[model samples]
Target: MKNIWISCAGIHDTLRFTFHSQLKVMLTVMNRRKLLLAFLACPILAAAPAFSHEGHGVSHVKTSVTLRKRRGRTLHLIVTFLNQGRDAVMLETVAVENAQVLNAVKTAVPAGALVEAPVSLRFHDDVPGIFTLMLDFGEHGKGPVTVTL
Candidate 1:
């Protein structure tokens, strides 16, 4: 066969052009993969925060009736509080149930803490059959739990 003649520089240029085209295609595929991954992860990234605590009206707050004392035309209640989460929780002063004394008392409870004493509450005149404790944990976290009558 007759010897084929080609310049060394011409060969190099053709190889370089092919390499650049392949590189460009690979880069485009990588960019598409990155965009797809980001799109798929959007929901998880915008997800609502998770709370360590779950029970009670709020995750961080837990309430119980330690003592219920009733007097003539008056009822006395002793409630307890506990925080099961790592962050502090704000407790509403007044409950959501009827016959509640709205004191608007707000208390910030530390995480992993418990109330030392029972909270004293009073009810005059008509006594409610059920007591509803409203809890606002913030971040769209709220609970309106009820105890016995």
Candidate 2:
């Protein structure tokens, strides 16, 4: 057997250079991750105010079925109109899908007040399933309010 000897010159310098390069790459990756997270959080922080505030918009009418009861083929409902805006609203028409609206809709809802009225809906056959009620607030807005019979 023969003995072999190897040189150890510049071994420490090579190891130090490799360690420093690896450390720099690790720090760069960590900084990039932090920057990405900060960018993602910017939009969420900006939209925080919108989520906290409720009903922050122009004059609009909100409708809901406060009371609902079924008797024979006539489904009686108490529709409540909430004027959340500054101006008053006049309910022009109230139409029920798959049913005939029997009551007249000429009620005036004052500003920031709630107005409830009796709405009688006559179905062709029988009161069945959920239905949608369409309301028209003249010059203000119009939308559909889902109601379950």
> What TM-score would each prediction reach against the true structure?
0.49, 0.56
Candidate 2 Cα outliers beyond 4 Å, as residue runs: 1-59
- The reply for model 1, stretches above 4 Å from the true place, is 1-57, 102-104, 116-125, 137-140
Please list the C-alpha lDDT of all candidates, in the order they appear. 0.60, 0.76
Displacement of the residue 41 alpha carbon in candidate 1, Å: 5.3
Estimate, for each residue in 1-149, the C-alpha lDDT of model 2 and write its tens digit. Answer: 22223334676766676676677778898999999999999999999998756443324677788557778888878888788877777888888767888985688988899889888989887677777887877765577888764
The number of the candidate with the highest lDDT is 2
lDDT of 1: 0.60
C-alpha positional error of residue 25 in candidate 1 after TM-score superposition, expressed in Å: 19
**What is candidate 2's TM-score against the reference?**
0.56
At residue 87, candidate 1 shows an lDDT of 67
Clashing residue pairs in candidate 2 are none
RMSD to true structure for each model, in Å: 10.3, 8.8
* Lowest summed lDDT window (length 10), candidate 1: 48-57
